[model samples]
Target: MEEGRSSKGGVKKEYKGGITPFVVGVSIVAATGGLVFGYDNGIAGGVTSMDPFLRKFFRATYRKMHQEEARSSAYCKFNSQILTTFTSSLYIAGLIASMVASPLTRLYGRKPSILVGGLSVLVGAAINGGALNVGMLIAGRIMLGIGIGFADQAVPLYLSEMAPKQIRGALNMGFQLFVSVGGLSASLTNYGTDKIQNWGWRLSLALAAVPAGILTLGSLWLPETPNSLMETQGPEKARAMLQRIRGTLDVEEELSDMMEATKTSEMVKHPLYNMLQRKYRPQLVMAVAIPMFQQLTGINAIVFYAPVLFRTIGFQTNASLMSAVILGVVGLAATVVSMIAVDRYGRRLLFLQGGLQMFVCQVIVAIILATKFDSSGDGSISKGYAYLLLVMICIYVVGFAWSWGPLGWLVPSEIFSLEVRSIGQSIVVAVNLLFTFAIAQGFLAMLCHFKYGIFLFFAGWVFLMTLFVYLFLPETKNIGIEEMNSVWTEHWFWKRFVNQEFHIPIGIKTSSNT
Candidate 1:
């Protein structure tokens, strides 16, 4: 394998060749999971805001939305429990389903989990399109949630494993990029279908199946990741695949490291229990904190409720849907910026910069709304201020799309060794979905009570999470996936928790090993 030395004199493996087309194609196909995730996020708000959709299953909410006096309680008009539950149930079910995906991913391989997720989404979309009642709507959403849980849990791991260390961050971010594309697709679909007087929402929900079907079929052709192969199919097949993936015959050094890690992992029957060991404290903390903090950023709250938010601020239904389309477009573009820049500028810089940008935008938006818009008066925001609010929200989306949106999945997927990787990913998915459910369920109520102050509340979280990264997170650029243990052991703080004895046999010529 190619090699390099850190400033501290630790040896590191660096892949030397250019990334092959085979890997790129595989990574793109695997990232369809993000599309499914993005579509749901984008579709929910637009569908809910549609008059026909609201009239059919949420008549009370529809009437409240259309009433003259509804302006008096702008944020409270959409506060129906059933309505929010329709949106939140998928996340809760996803949270549960992710926990179930942990072992299955380890046993059957990443492709299977992705395929199952896609199939579940396919069925869920069909059910949702044909739903006859609220119960059927929720049931369909639950199936969709299960599908997302599985896909979200496995896709990041699959991408991380398959990508060469040189562009792992960029490749992994492809998942988030597709997520943006899916959201954009959903927003565009919602805009077009809103004109269909009676069943526009049905079409919006059904189109989710198109991407899900692609993922399901695409997964059938995916090569099992080398890391997964090593763990489950022995070293010979793992080496063969690694060589094929790398487009090189000189994969012995990397394959040897994979074999060593897999051999150690084989002795651990329960990765969940193993994760609780003191040595894994860093991984454990990150798996919980990263995903939890990602949700706390309040990006999802905006994505999930953008149409409602714009309408609450006095935009027309078509205007609200169109505004969501704007946010999706901006987000998709920003994610492309991240994909191109992440490896060059590094993850920590993006996180810090994006955090500062989002925090500033949120505070400014809150200030503008609090000072200029009279919440107690029965009037919509002025045209200039309405567009201004949309501008600030778009900036906020840019900040998140480039930073937390992708790194939350990338960092967690890369940190864990072969043994705990699957379970570690499960924790990430579960925590992310749990807080996502909480935000979807509570955001409307919080908006009603807190009003503009809700933005300030998220600003506080953004501050704390930024500080957490500045203090605790180590820069992981250029590190091989299997060699991540070195990063923790070298960090000034985390080193105390990492067992000095712990090492991956990657031919590192450290003085101690020598």
Candidate 2:
């Protein structure tokens, strides 16, 4: 690598020391928590139409009802309500867990917080898999929610702190990509088990415990993040950990940057004040607004209730579960595209394009759902509209994965200043969980009343979010965490997103190759 001058009249210093395998390994291990998150969501979403699932909890009777009696239309509607409660129960516990994350992370450090979270997930799985009644199942789902709430915020925060500036976006996106893998695994697992007797859905729910166990065990052996180590053990220990993680002895430059950032460390103790300060107002706005819009896209409603959505669109029980598998694959592939593009094209471009694409998919689906099918007749969708619905749903997932999935996690983690970074993350994560719960729990009600209006509702949000990104959010490609404040302060709205031509170029200090 060599130094040079750019057309913008800035000096450039290149980096030759590459990232080591250990860093990559640790990043993957830390991100496996995301696998548990996805698996949990998929298992709940996929199990709704399983005969075993419906008969076991929804229609099981001490009143002498048999298999044929359990399939009654009245019984089916009641099952929908139970299934909705079962899935939403996880979120209630998750919302509670996320609200308390600041205290948990403060007392235990990142590693232990995640370890406990993983164990909680495994315990929840056991409870859910072995349940013999609806009450027990709801109890288990609540525990699962608590566990996912713990991992949801902690994993991304750890990844964002551990990764180098060169590949930070990729590593963070990897967290989300693995989430899709967990989803894919769940969908395949459900498809494999969909034909079994009453035990099939139980097996699907229990299978996720394997990944949670892996996450717990892997995190136990990993080192604490550099930022956490620096705060607790001082610079020498932090530097040693950084060298080991980065696989380089020449860490003086990054070390200096971290030291300056650490000066704001006091605010972590009193994060609420810092988060509300005048200086941080804009970043806080961006953090809250983006995640809010992300949920408003109805992505979680799709993730947690896709089988139900497809059921309305005319697919049979097992076929709807299989369709979810396809959606999961499409989502995984799109996330890979985001991992590649996030660093190169920047967050703003992806958001701008992804939002518009999602709106297009939603509008087409909405028009067909609104007019083409008779809601009062057979619940099965016509073949023409069903195929169209499937394709559009998959495309909507592509748009979501490329923009909201990774960016929602990455932006909130990166936008805040150091003082409130951790707590700001919890608040943002809590908001996401809260909205997810609201959307998931309330979606069935929305569908009953609004029909295609629900899709139109989400489409309108997409348009608003697209405008929000273009006007308010700045591109945060390779900027240092310490330098994010300057980006928000840029006066010209148009100048905020375009790179190189803008006033303060990304990668910070143009003389340095980060």
Candidate 3:
């Protein structure tokens, strides 16, 4: 059994209590990768419109002359395409990297994997800020994507393991909060430097390095997940790390739970491979499908293309940038609200309500766009409609922030057993990253080809997601990890999806009251 403490000096001491602060602090610090992820994505929304910077850095070239003028002008149609491609190709690379993250995490401990990812971001940020050409920028973006892949895979898993049962939902919501903060920071920075486009975009991109550096340096002092340590190292090492992380909590009980969950003692060769077998397929499906559905909602398209979409509604470039900033502010606010509400109301209810809300917003936006409410004689949209579009987009963002933005990470962690948690999360994130890549690559094409139909497509997805949440997802707030395995075992809807039949053992079912 792991070590425990006796009451001393009139204080009731627990084995895990002493280490809790360190665990929480380290987990939050390591999770800054989410911040870097958001910063890289958010910077482009405003930076794309920096005309002076573009003109200064990407000047017209005679070799690409059109009618005796340089055709490679930053505002030229081709240059716009180049910029869009540069902005999105990294997402594609990240999508591919996410697919491998599960296997990588299984092999390397989460802490080291995250450190490597953080270093990659630092490198990518430096390369991107100094890029002399579009090709180099694209390469830098790919590198950043690789870093995100690692963070995306590891951060949630680490948080799930470290957080106490009572606060897991709230703590996981921190990931979404950081993501919003990163977006807000980028928007504010871009807005502040709108007048100095030459240095503004570069500066914003480079700022991503600061968080990456902090996370890398801080992780050195952080303890690995006690579960990982126990399974990979021996119980003695795991106990020491747990004592450091949990402080005065009942370390023996926690260690016993970890041991019970570990598959290493059995004849099974690999825990992840064992999970992929017929027994755990249901958990696997929920894990992968939740994140896949999250991305299919087209959140990334809105995030990455917000400025462009607003521009289409007739706003001037600067106005659109400002509007995008407003959207970021609204998103941040809604996410904060979600962080508070998620633990109180539970994950399933919020998801159902949020999905339905997004559906309504998307449909309304589609209608407005389809009717061309403020288009000029030449079929170009006017600036007046930009305000309406921005409001609707904000509403849509609120819906997403309150639902999938947090629950996407929260639910998967809650649903899967500890044995498959890492691999399951990796797969879930991989699907999300893949769809994100698809949206990033095809958003402009869909916009140009079908015009308002893109919104309609997303609207349908939100509707489906709403239905899925109501049908399959269970409330997981305040539930212990060990108790979660039985939730699906007892529910009829979940039973149909789970491949292996199991009974909810006695003493496992607790009060459903929130």
Error of 3 at 246 (Å): 3.7
lDDT by residue for model 2 over 337-441, one digit each (tens)?
A: 999999899999999899999999999988987777666535445798898899999999999999988898888887766567777777787778788877878
Candidate 3 residue-wise lDDT, 338-433, digit = tens: 988887888888898899889988888888777754332222554556567778889999999888988888788667676677777777777777
Scored by lDDT, model 2 comes in at: 0.77
Best by TM-score: 1
Candidate 1 residue pairs that clash: none
TM-score of each: 0.97, 0.89, 0.86
Report every candidate's CA lDDT: 0.90, 0.77, 0.71
Clash totals, every prediction: 0, 2, 19
TM-score of 2: 0.89
Q: Higher-lDDT candidate among 1 and 2?
A: 1
Q: Which stretches of model 3 miss by more than 4 angstroms? A: 1-20, 52-82, 264-273, 372-384, 496-514
> Which of the two candidates, 2 or 3, achieves a greater TM-score against the reference?
2
Q: Residue 195 lDDT in model 3?
A: 65
